[model samples]
Target: MGFLTDTTHMHIFTWVVGIVLFLVAASMANGTKGKKITHMILRLFYVLIIITGAALFFKHMTIDSMLYGIKFVLGILTIGFMEMVLVRGNKGKNTGLMWILFIIALLATMFIGFKLPMGFNFFA
Candidate 1:
């Protein structure tokens, strides 16, 4: 119960879960034998990420509200780009733009996350 209120723990938990699920969804999206279930699972993971992320955001927001807001927008864009890539890939359509967007969103998200106060320091 205490961990539920611990923003650091919550952030780590959600990050790992979201990343693992994102990888799984990406793999499934690119597979020739894909299933609708993969989309459903991805959607579930996205919802989980949002919920946990909201908790983390509300609990740990700093005086630099603009930076936090940027991180927050990047987080949502990350999810949106992910879904775009999945959709376009599943349809066997050109996904270059989607891939580019996803990569940019991911890098931005990670960069901002690491720079934020109380955020994860992968080097440490």
Candidate 2:
């Protein structure tokens, strides 16, 4: 139970995995054949990300909920666009727009995440 609330470790681990999976999914999207198993596993990783993210959100909420809220929304969007890119890529459809959206969402999410209180100190 305690692990569920303080999920920084789990969150970071899953976040790294999710990024790696995203790259795999993106590459597969460019192929003629589809990777059902990869997509399925990626979906599972996404759920883990969301669960840990929600836990982190509530655990670190502050007076200015706006920043956290923005991060929350962007995080969800990042997953969404990632999924979209996979789907479109499998269908051999144009995924340029989804790629752009996913990258923007990802960058924004990471920036906000690192800017949080006692968050990742890139300079450190």
Candidate 3:
């Protein structure tokens, strides 16, 4: 079942890679040099964060086996939100709230890799 184990890892990896690329490409398409660089760096960090987090998740996670899935969805949502609201128009019109939410989501996402108390699965 080595391939089966690899499937899950590959699934997560591909999804993360795809979303980051989509975000970076979208940012580049918008023609903002600063945003492009920032987005690219953030996207790279997003991949690294997920990769390292995956290792931690395998070692300590319990309760919600779906935490990774939830994080995946949130990653997509966060990228979409950034594209639609922050990067959509002026690219500089106050996005403090969006940035705050993005950072919060990223932090929360990182935390999901660790174990938590019983019967506290957010998805449940």
Best by lDDT: 2
Task: TM-score each candidate.
Answer: 0.80, 0.88, 0.40
Worst 10 residues of 2 by lDDT: 26-35
lDDT of each: 0.76, 0.84, 0.53
In what order do the candidates fall by TM-score, top score first? Answer: 2, 1, 3
Write one digit per residue (lDDT tens) for candidate 1, span 42-89.
Answer: 688788778777777777777756677788889999989888877887
Candidate 3 residue-wise lDDT at 87: 58
- Cα error, candidate 3, residue 24 (Å): 11
Off by over 4 Å in 1: 29-34, 122-124
Q: Model 2 residue 29 lDDT?
A: 34
Residues 16-93, model 3: lDDT tens digits: 664565455544545667656756665665565455445444544556567756765665565555555445444546
Q: What's the lDDT for candidate 1? A: 0.76
Candidate 1 C-alpha error for residue 10, in Å: 3.0
Please give the range of 10 consecutive residues that has the lowest summed lDDT in model 3: 112-121
